[model samples]
Target: MSVHTACPVTTRKTLGQVLVCLGCCCGRTDKGHPPVPVDWLKSEWKRRMLPKKIHLSISGCLGPCDASNVVLILYGQEAIFLGGLHEETHYLALADWATDCDHQGCLVPLPESLEPFRLERFVDEPVAAGAA
Candidate 1:
Protein backbone atom coordinates (compact mmCIF):
# COMPACT_ATOMS: atom_id res chain seq x y z
CA MET A 1 0.00 0.00 0.00
CA SER A 2 2.89 2.33 0.78
CA VAL A 3 4.53 1.64 -2.53
CA HIS A 4 4.46 5.22 -3.75
CA THR A 5 7.21 7.37 -2.24
CA ALA A 6 7.17 11.09 -1.80
CA CYS A 7 9.70 12.82 -3.98
CA PRO A 8 12.68 14.47 -2.35
CA VAL A 9 11.42 17.21 -0.05
CA THR A 10 13.77 19.76 -1.52
CA THR A 11 12.66 19.02 -5.05
CA ARG A 12 9.39 20.07 -6.62
CA LYS A 13 6.78 17.68 -7.95
CA THR A 14 3.57 17.88 -9.93
CA LEU A 15 0.43 15.77 -10.00
CA GLY A 16 0.44 14.81 -13.65
CA GLN A 17 4.09 14.03 -14.06
CA VAL A 18 4.08 10.35 -13.17
CA LEU A 19 6.65 7.64 -13.49
CA VAL A 20 5.64 3.97 -13.63
CA CYS A 21 8.93 3.43 -11.76
CA LEU A 22 8.98 -0.25 -12.75
CA GLY A 23 8.61 -2.45 -9.68
CA CYS A 24 8.52 0.52 -7.31
CA CYS A 25 5.18 -0.99 -6.57
CA CYS A 26 4.78 -4.74 -7.06
CA GLY A 27 2.81 -7.75 -8.11
CA ARG A 28 3.17 -11.16 -6.43
CA THR A 29 5.00 -12.95 -9.19
CA ASP A 30 8.77 -13.33 -9.21
CA LYS A 31 8.48 -11.82 -12.67
CA GLY A 32 6.75 -8.69 -11.44
CA HIS A 33 6.26 -6.35 -14.34
CA PRO A 34 4.27 -3.20 -13.73
CA PRO A 35 1.67 -3.45 -16.45
CA VAL A 36 3.24 -1.12 -18.96
CA PRO A 37 0.21 0.41 -20.72
CA VAL A 38 -1.60 1.34 -17.54
CA ASP A 39 1.52 2.93 -16.14
CA TRP A 40 2.04 4.74 -19.42
CA LEU A 41 -1.55 5.94 -19.37
CA LYS A 42 -1.18 7.42 -15.89
CA SER A 43 1.93 9.37 -16.81
CA GLU A 44 0.07 11.01 -19.66
CA TRP A 45 -2.51 12.42 -17.23
CA LYS A 46 0.03 14.81 -15.70
CA ARG A 47 -1.10 17.51 -18.14
CA ARG A 48 -4.71 17.25 -16.98
CA MET A 49 -4.25 16.48 -13.26
CA LEU A 50 -1.14 18.59 -13.26
CA PRO A 51 0.18 16.11 -10.65
CA LYS A 52 3.45 18.06 -10.89
CA LYS A 53 4.57 14.47 -10.78
CA ILE A 54 2.14 11.62 -10.82
CA HIS A 55 3.78 8.41 -9.71
CA LEU A 56 2.71 4.98 -10.97
CA SER A 57 4.14 1.56 -10.23
CA ILE A 58 2.99 -2.01 -9.76
CA SER A 59 1.77 -2.53 -6.26
CA GLY A 60 0.98 -5.91 -4.73
CA CYS A 61 -1.08 -8.20 -6.87
CA LEU A 62 -4.78 -7.80 -6.46
CA GLY A 63 -5.34 -11.53 -6.80
CA PRO A 64 -7.93 -13.73 -8.49
CA CYS A 65 -5.48 -14.96 -11.03
CA ASP A 66 -8.48 -14.60 -13.28
CA ALA A 67 -7.88 -10.93 -12.85
CA SER A 68 -4.14 -11.21 -13.24
CA ASN A 69 -4.69 -9.42 -16.49
CA VAL A 70 -5.66 -6.32 -14.56
CA VAL A 71 -4.46 -2.78 -13.87
CA LEU A 72 -5.04 0.18 -11.62
CA ILE A 73 -5.82 3.61 -12.98
CA LEU A 74 -5.48 7.06 -11.42
CA TYR A 75 -3.74 5.79 -8.31
CA GLY A 76 -6.45 3.26 -7.60
CA GLN A 77 -9.33 5.71 -8.02
CA GLU A 78 -10.32 3.39 -10.86
CA ALA A 79 -9.19 0.01 -12.10
CA ILE A 80 -9.48 -1.58 -15.51
CA PHE A 81 -8.34 -4.64 -17.42
CA LEU A 82 -6.24 -5.83 -20.36
CA GLY A 83 -9.15 -7.94 -21.66
CA GLY A 84 -7.88 -10.89 -23.69
CA LEU A 85 -4.85 -8.86 -24.56
CA HIS A 86 -1.20 -9.16 -25.24
CA GLU A 87 1.31 -6.51 -24.12
CA GLU A 88 1.66 -4.60 -27.39
CA THR A 89 -1.90 -3.40 -28.00
CA HIS A 90 -2.90 -3.71 -24.37
CA TYR A 91 -0.43 -1.14 -23.07
CA LEU A 92 -1.12 1.25 -25.93
CA ALA A 93 -4.85 1.38 -25.36
CA LEU A 94 -4.56 1.69 -21.60
CA ALA A 95 -2.18 4.61 -21.84
CA ASP A 96 -4.48 6.25 -24.35
CA TRP A 97 -7.62 5.90 -22.28
CA ALA A 98 -6.14 6.78 -18.85
CA THR A 99 -4.07 9.77 -19.91
CA ASP A 100 -7.03 11.26 -21.71
CA CYS A 101 -9.37 10.82 -18.76
CA ASP A 102 -11.19 13.99 -17.81
CA HIS A 103 -12.30 15.49 -14.49
CA GLN A 104 -15.65 13.77 -14.93
CA GLY A 105 -14.11 10.38 -14.09
CA CYS A 106 -14.64 9.42 -17.68
CA LEU A 107 -11.92 8.25 -19.96
CA VAL A 108 -11.88 9.26 -23.63
CA PRO A 109 -12.89 5.75 -24.60
CA LEU A 110 -10.48 3.13 -25.88
CA PRO A 111 -8.89 3.09 -29.30
CA GLU A 112 -10.37 0.90 -31.98
CA SER A 113 -7.46 -1.47 -32.04
CA LEU A 114 -7.77 -2.13 -28.33
CA GLU A 115 -11.51 -2.47 -28.18
CA PRO A 116 -11.25 -6.16 -27.41
CA PHE A 117 -9.19 -5.79 -24.25
CA ARG A 118 -11.39 -3.37 -22.35
CA LEU A 119 -12.72 -4.59 -19.05
CA GLU A 120 -16.08 -3.25 -17.89
CA ARG A 121 -15.10 -2.93 -14.23
CA PHE A 122 -12.20 -3.60 -11.95
CA VAL A 123 -12.99 -5.20 -8.60
CA ASP A 124 -11.57 -3.21 -5.66
CA GLU A 125 -8.63 -4.51 -3.64
CA PRO A 126 -8.90 -7.47 -5.94
CA VAL A 127 -6.04 -9.21 -4.12
CA ALA A 128 -8.03 -9.23 -0.89
CA ALA A 129 -11.27 -10.06 -2.62
CA GLY A 130 -9.70 -13.24 -3.92
CA ALA A 131 -9.69 -12.06 -7.53
CA ALA A 132 -8.89 -15.58 -8.60
Candidate 2:
Protein backbone atom coordinates (compact mmCIF):
# COMPACT_ATOMS: atom_id res chain seq x y z
CA MET A 1 0.00 0.00 0.00
CA SER A 2 1.14 3.52 -0.76
CA VAL A 3 1.34 6.26 1.82
CA HIS A 4 -1.94 8.01 2.52
CA THR A 5 -1.64 11.78 2.46
CA ALA A 6 -4.74 12.58 4.43
CA CYS A 7 -5.79 11.65 7.92
CA PRO A 8 -9.28 12.37 9.24
CA VAL A 9 -7.97 13.01 12.70
CA THR A 10 -6.02 16.24 12.31
CA THR A 11 -3.68 18.07 10.00
CA ARG A 12 -0.86 19.16 12.21
CA LYS A 13 2.70 19.85 11.11
CA THR A 14 4.58 17.38 13.20
CA LEU A 15 7.95 16.01 12.22
CA GLY A 16 6.81 12.55 13.24
CA GLN A 17 5.27 10.55 16.04
CA VAL A 18 5.13 6.81 16.63
CA LEU A 19 2.65 5.14 18.94
CA VAL A 20 3.07 1.46 19.69
CA CYS A 21 0.09 -0.17 21.28
CA LEU A 22 0.71 -2.44 24.24
CA GLY A 23 -2.86 -2.95 25.33
CA CYS A 24 -5.33 -5.86 25.40
CA CYS A 25 -4.73 -7.55 22.06
CA CYS A 26 -1.70 -5.84 20.69
CA GLY A 27 1.27 -7.08 22.61
CA ARG A 28 -0.38 -9.87 24.51
CA THR A 29 1.12 -13.26 23.74
CA ASP A 30 -1.82 -14.86 25.48
CA LYS A 31 -4.09 -13.29 22.93
CA GLY A 32 -2.20 -15.11 20.14
CA HIS A 33 -0.32 -11.99 19.09
CA PRO A 34 3.41 -11.91 18.84
CA PRO A 35 5.38 -10.19 21.54
CA VAL A 36 6.48 -6.61 21.12
CA PRO A 37 10.13 -6.06 21.73
CA VAL A 38 9.52 -3.28 24.19
CA ASP A 39 12.96 -3.14 25.73
CA TRP A 40 14.74 -3.34 22.42
CA LEU A 41 12.55 -0.70 20.89
CA LYS A 42 13.14 1.63 23.80
CA SER A 43 16.86 1.08 23.70
CA GLU A 44 17.01 1.69 19.98
CA TRP A 45 14.93 4.84 20.24
CA LYS A 46 17.16 6.13 22.99
CA ARG A 47 20.32 5.06 21.25
CA ARG A 48 19.41 7.05 18.20
CA MET A 49 18.23 9.97 20.28
CA LEU A 50 15.07 9.93 18.21
CA PRO A 51 13.14 11.95 20.79
CA LYS A 52 14.75 15.10 19.43
CA LYS A 53 12.98 14.68 16.11
CA ILE A 54 10.50 11.88 16.46
CA HIS A 55 8.11 11.40 19.33
CA LEU A 56 7.72 7.84 20.53
CA SER A 57 4.94 6.74 22.81
CA ILE A 58 4.39 3.17 23.92
CA SER A 59 0.72 3.48 24.63
CA GLY A 60 -2.24 1.40 25.69
CA CYS A 61 -5.11 0.40 23.45
CA LEU A 62 -4.77 2.37 20.27
CA GLY A 63 -7.97 0.40 19.48
CA PRO A 64 -8.84 -1.94 16.58
CA CYS A 65 -7.97 -4.62 19.04
CA ASP A 66 -7.96 -7.35 16.41
CA ALA A 67 -5.09 -5.60 14.74
CA SER A 68 -2.42 -6.95 16.97
CA ASN A 69 1.03 -5.40 17.21
CA VAL A 70 -0.41 -2.12 16.08
CA VAL A 71 1.70 0.90 15.42
CA LEU A 72 0.44 4.33 14.49
CA ILE A 73 2.78 6.75 12.85
CA LEU A 74 1.95 10.38 12.27
CA TYR A 75 4.32 12.27 10.10
CA GLY A 76 3.86 15.73 8.72
CA GLN A 77 0.25 15.72 7.55
CA GLU A 78 -0.24 12.00 7.27
CA ALA A 79 -1.12 9.21 9.64
CA ILE A 80 0.05 5.67 8.90
CA PHE A 81 -1.45 2.70 10.64
CA LEU A 82 0.51 -0.53 10.56
CA GLY A 83 -0.38 -3.88 12.04
CA GLY A 84 0.73 -7.52 12.16
CA LEU A 85 4.26 -6.48 12.89
CA HIS A 86 5.67 -9.57 14.59
CA GLU A 87 9.28 -9.61 13.65
CA GLU A 88 12.48 -8.03 14.90
CA THR A 89 13.11 -6.63 11.44
CA HIS A 90 9.87 -4.74 11.62
CA TYR A 91 11.11 -2.87 14.65
CA LEU A 92 14.45 -2.30 12.99
CA ALA A 93 12.74 -0.89 9.95
CA LEU A 94 10.77 1.43 12.20
CA ALA A 95 13.98 2.76 13.71
CA ASP A 96 15.51 3.16 10.31
CA TRP A 97 12.48 4.97 9.00
CA ALA A 98 12.49 7.33 11.98
CA THR A 99 16.21 7.97 11.65
CA ASP A 100 15.83 8.78 7.98
CA CYS A 101 13.01 11.19 8.63
CA ASP A 102 14.98 12.78 11.45
CA HIS A 103 17.98 13.28 9.22
CA GLN A 104 15.82 14.79 6.53
CA GLY A 105 13.97 16.97 8.99
CA CYS A 106 10.66 16.07 7.40
CA LEU A 107 8.37 13.19 6.61
CA VAL A 108 9.46 10.57 4.18
CA PRO A 109 7.72 7.69 2.49
CA LEU A 110 7.78 4.51 4.54
CA PRO A 111 10.33 1.98 3.45
CA GLU A 112 9.10 -0.46 0.85
CA SER A 113 9.59 -3.29 3.28
CA LEU A 114 6.87 -1.93 5.51
CA GLU A 115 4.31 -1.37 2.82
CA PRO A 116 2.70 -4.75 3.30
CA PHE A 117 1.95 -3.95 6.93
CA ARG A 118 0.09 -0.73 6.09
CA LEU A 119 -3.45 -0.79 7.41
CA GLU A 120 -6.52 1.10 6.27
CA ARG A 121 -7.95 1.48 9.71
CA PHE A 122 -9.71 4.79 9.11
CA VAL A 123 -12.58 5.35 6.77
CA ASP A 124 -13.81 8.58 5.23
CA GLU A 125 -17.46 7.56 5.32
CA PRO A 126 -19.47 6.89 8.40
CA VAL A 127 -20.80 3.38 8.85
CA ALA A 128 -24.42 2.91 7.92
CA ALA A 129 -26.91 2.06 10.62
CA GLY A 130 -26.78 -1.57 11.79
CA ALA A 131 -23.65 -2.28 9.80
CA ALA A 132 -21.22 -4.59 11.41
Candidate 3:
Protein backbone atom coordinates (compact mmCIF):
# COMPACT_ATOMS: atom_id res chain seq x y z
CA MET A 1 0.00 0.00 0.00
CA SER A 2 1.29 3.50 -0.83
CA VAL A 3 1.32 5.58 2.32
CA HIS A 4 2.09 8.82 0.58
CA THR A 5 -0.08 10.73 -1.84
CA ALA A 6 0.95 13.50 -4.18
CA CYS A 7 -0.46 16.96 -3.74
CA PRO A 8 0.11 20.32 -5.37
CA VAL A 9 2.40 22.61 -3.44
CA THR A 10 2.56 26.35 -4.04
CA THR A 11 5.04 28.83 -2.65
CA ARG A 12 3.47 31.67 -0.72
CA LYS A 13 4.91 35.12 -0.17
CA THR A 14 4.58 36.30 3.38
CA LEU A 15 5.70 39.27 5.39
CA GLY A 16 6.50 37.22 8.47
CA GLN A 17 6.10 33.83 10.14
CA VAL A 18 4.68 32.56 13.39
CA LEU A 19 5.98 29.27 14.72
CA VAL A 20 4.10 27.46 17.46
CA CYS A 21 6.07 24.76 19.23
CA LEU A 22 4.21 21.60 20.14
CA GLY A 23 7.23 19.88 21.54
CA CYS A 24 7.41 17.23 24.22
CA CYS A 25 6.72 19.75 26.91
CA CYS A 26 4.55 22.16 25.03
CA GLY A 27 0.93 21.15 24.40
CA ARG A 28 1.25 18.28 26.87
CA THR A 29 -1.48 18.88 29.36
CA ASP A 30 -0.61 15.65 31.09
CA LYS A 31 2.81 17.07 31.84
CA GLY A 32 1.27 20.07 33.60
CA HIS A 33 1.65 22.46 30.68
CA PRO A 34 -1.39 24.09 29.21
CA PRO A 35 -2.89 22.78 26.01
CA VAL A 36 -2.10 24.61 22.78
CA PRO A 37 -5.16 25.95 21.03
CA VAL A 38 -4.13 24.59 17.68
CA ASP A 39 -7.58 24.48 16.14
CA TRP A 40 -8.47 27.97 17.25
CA LEU A 41 -5.19 29.35 15.99
CA LYS A 42 -5.63 27.74 12.60
CA SER A 43 -9.17 29.01 12.31
CA GLU A 44 -8.14 32.51 13.30
CA TRP A 45 -5.25 32.55 10.87
CA LYS A 46 -7.46 31.48 8.00
CA ARG A 47 -10.29 33.79 8.99
CA ARG A 48 -7.91 36.72 9.10
CA MET A 49 -6.38 35.76 5.75
CA LEU A 50 -2.94 35.69 7.33
CA PRO A 51 -1.55 33.16 4.86
CA LYS A 52 -1.06 36.03 2.36
CA LYS A 53 0.84 38.20 4.84
CA ILE A 54 2.02 35.89 7.61
CA HIS A 55 2.83 32.23 7.54
CA LEU A 56 1.76 30.09 10.45
CA SER A 57 3.52 26.83 11.16
CA ILE A 58 2.79 24.45 13.97
CA SER A 59 6.12 22.78 14.57
CA GLY A 60 7.67 20.36 17.01
CA CYS A 61 10.55 20.80 19.47
CA LEU A 62 11.68 24.38 19.08
CA GLY A 63 14.33 23.75 21.80
CA PRO A 64 14.46 25.40 25.19
CA CYS A 65 12.26 22.68 26.52
CA ASP A 66 12.37 24.41 29.87
CA ALA A 67 10.02 26.98 28.44
CA SER A 68 6.93 25.11 27.49
CA ASN A 69 4.23 26.50 25.24
CA VAL A 70 6.74 28.55 23.28
CA VAL A 71 5.99 30.68 20.24
CA LEU A 72 8.40 32.34 17.88
CA ILE A 73 7.48 35.31 15.71
CA LEU A 74 9.78 36.23 12.86
CA TYR A 75 9.34 39.72 11.49
CA GLY A 76 11.88 41.18 9.13
CA GLN A 77 15.32 40.53 10.66
CA GLU A 78 14.01 40.21 14.19
CA ALA A 79 13.05 36.97 15.91
CA ILE A 80 10.81 37.47 18.89
CA PHE A 81 10.66 34.65 21.41
CA LEU A 82 7.60 34.26 23.54
CA GLY A 83 7.21 31.71 26.33
CA GLY A 84 4.74 30.60 28.97
CA LEU A 85 1.71 31.20 26.81
CA HIS A 86 -0.66 29.05 28.90
CA GLU A 87 -3.87 30.90 28.34
CA GLU A 88 -6.51 31.12 25.64
CA THR A 89 -6.21 34.89 25.87
CA HIS A 90 -2.55 34.62 24.92
CA TYR A 91 -3.50 32.83 21.73
CA LEU A 92 -6.18 35.39 21.00
CA ALA A 93 -3.70 38.18 21.55
CA LEU A 94 -1.32 36.57 19.11
CA ALA A 95 -4.05 36.33 16.48
CA ASP A 96 -4.92 39.95 17.06
CA TRP A 97 -1.32 41.03 16.78
CA ALA A 98 -0.89 39.21 13.49
CA THR A 99 -4.14 40.64 12.12
CA ASP A 100 -3.04 44.15 13.04
CA CYS A 101 0.31 43.71 11.40
CA ASP A 102 -1.32 42.40 8.25
CA HIS A 103 -3.74 45.30 8.11
CA GLN A 104 -0.95 47.87 8.64
CA GLY A 105 1.25 46.19 6.04
CA CYS A 106 4.12 46.14 8.56
CA LEU A 107 5.16 44.83 11.91
CA VAL A 108 3.55 46.59 14.80
CA PRO A 109 4.25 46.75 18.51
CA LEU A 110 2.90 43.84 20.52
CA PRO A 111 -0.28 44.50 22.35
CA GLU A 112 -0.19 44.86 26.13
CA SER A 113 -1.88 41.51 26.62
CA LEU A 114 1.12 39.73 25.12
CA GLU A 115 3.80 41.90 26.65
CA PRO A 116 4.22 39.61 29.62
CA PHE A 117 4.92 36.57 27.46
CA ARG A 118 7.92 38.11 25.72
CA LEU A 119 11.09 36.23 26.60
CA GLU A 120 14.80 36.44 25.77
CA ARG A 121 16.14 33.00 24.96
CA PHE A 122 19.23 34.17 23.06
CA VAL A 123 21.64 36.92 23.93
CA ASP A 124 24.12 38.76 21.71
CA GLU A 125 27.74 39.07 22.77
CA PRO A 126 29.11 42.53 23.40
CA VAL A 127 31.95 43.81 21.21
CA ALA A 128 35.38 44.23 22.78
CA ALA A 129 36.63 47.80 23.25
CA GLY A 130 38.57 48.85 20.09
CA ALA A 131 38.72 45.26 18.86
CA ALA A 132 38.22 46.20 15.22
Tens-digit lDDT string for candidate 1 (4-109): 7764558553223222323333332455533445444555554445343334454444433443445444433344444334464566554555455534344454
How close is each model in CA RMSD to the real structure?
8.9, 6.3, 8.4
How do these models rank on lDDT, best leading? Answer: 3, 2, 1
State the lDDT at 122 in candidate 3: 71
Record all residue pairs in model 2 with backbone atoms less than 3 Å apart, i.e. clashing.
none
**TM-score of candidate 2 versus the correct structure, residues matched by position:** 0.82
Q: Whole-model lDDT, candidate 1? A: 0.45
* Residue 86 in candidate 2, Cα distance off native in Å: 0.8
Model 3 scores a TM of 0.83
Worst 10 residues of 1 by lDDT: 13-22
- State the lDDT of candidate 2 residue by residue for 20-73, as single tens digits: 999988889987999999999899999999876788899999877777899999
Please identify which of the two predictions, 2 or 3, would achieve the higher TM-score against the true structure: 3
Q: In model 2, where do residues sit more than 4 Å from their true spots? A: 1-14, 127-132
